[model samples]
Target: MPEEVKAHITGVVFQVLAKPGDTVGAGDAILVLESMKMEIPVEAPRAGTVSAIKAKEGETVQEGDTVALLE
Candidate 1:
């Protein structure tokens, strides 16, 4: 099964820390988001291989928007 990582706040994608096929463990930081002058980390919810990235650096994303997927 694949897991989608969603944004918790409306923000700009500050950085992408993982690429497709990258291995990630639960709680691993996958990306960073900047919102309201605060930096928030988007972490992996489960251990899996990164399957897709939907948000890119400088891209704007809203709360609940899927930023990446893992399988």
Candidate 2:
């Protein structure tokens, strides 16, 4: 099954740490969001291969937006 990694808050995507086809463990940081002068990391919900990155660096994302896909 595929899992979606979502943003927890509205913010600008600061960095993308994983690319498609990358293997990731549970809780591994996939990206970071900059909001209110703080950096928030978006982590994998489970161990899997990173299938896609929906958000890009410097892009603005809303709360609950899917940032990446894992499978």
Candidate 3:
């Protein structure tokens, strides 16, 4: 089954820390999001291998948007 890493708040993607085919653990920072002048690290919801990146650096994302796919 596939899982998703989602944004917790509306923000612009500041950077992508993981790529497709990368392994990640729960609480690992997968990307950074900039909102209200603050940079927030988006972490994995659970341990999984990254299957795809759905958001890019500098892209705007809303709360609950999928930033990446994990499995």
Which candidate number maximizes TM-score? 2
Task: Report backbone clashes per prediction.
Answer: 0, 0, 0
RMSD of 2: 0.7
List where candidate 2 sits over 4 angstroms from the true fold.
Answer: none
Query: What's the CA error at residue 49 for candidate 3, in Å?
Result: 0.3
Angstrom error at residue 23, model 3: 0.6
Residue by residue across 33-63, what tens digits does model 3's lDDT show? 9999999999999999999999989999999
* 36: Cα error in model 2, Å: 1.9
Q: Model 2, range 1-71, lDDT digits (tens) per residue?
A: 68889999999999999999999999999999999899999999889999999998999999999999999
Q: Estimate every model's Cα lDDT from 0 to 1.
A: 0.94, 0.95, 0.94
Arrange candidates by TM-score, descending. 2, 3, 1
Clashes (candidate 1) = 0
* Candidate 3, lDDT over the whole model: 0.94
The positional error of residue 65 in candidate 1, measured at the CA in angstroms, is 0.4
Compute each candidate's TM-score over C-alphas: 0.94, 0.96, 0.95
- The best-first sequence of candidates by lDDT reads 2, 3, 1
Using alpha carbons, what is the TM-score of model 1?
Answer: 0.94
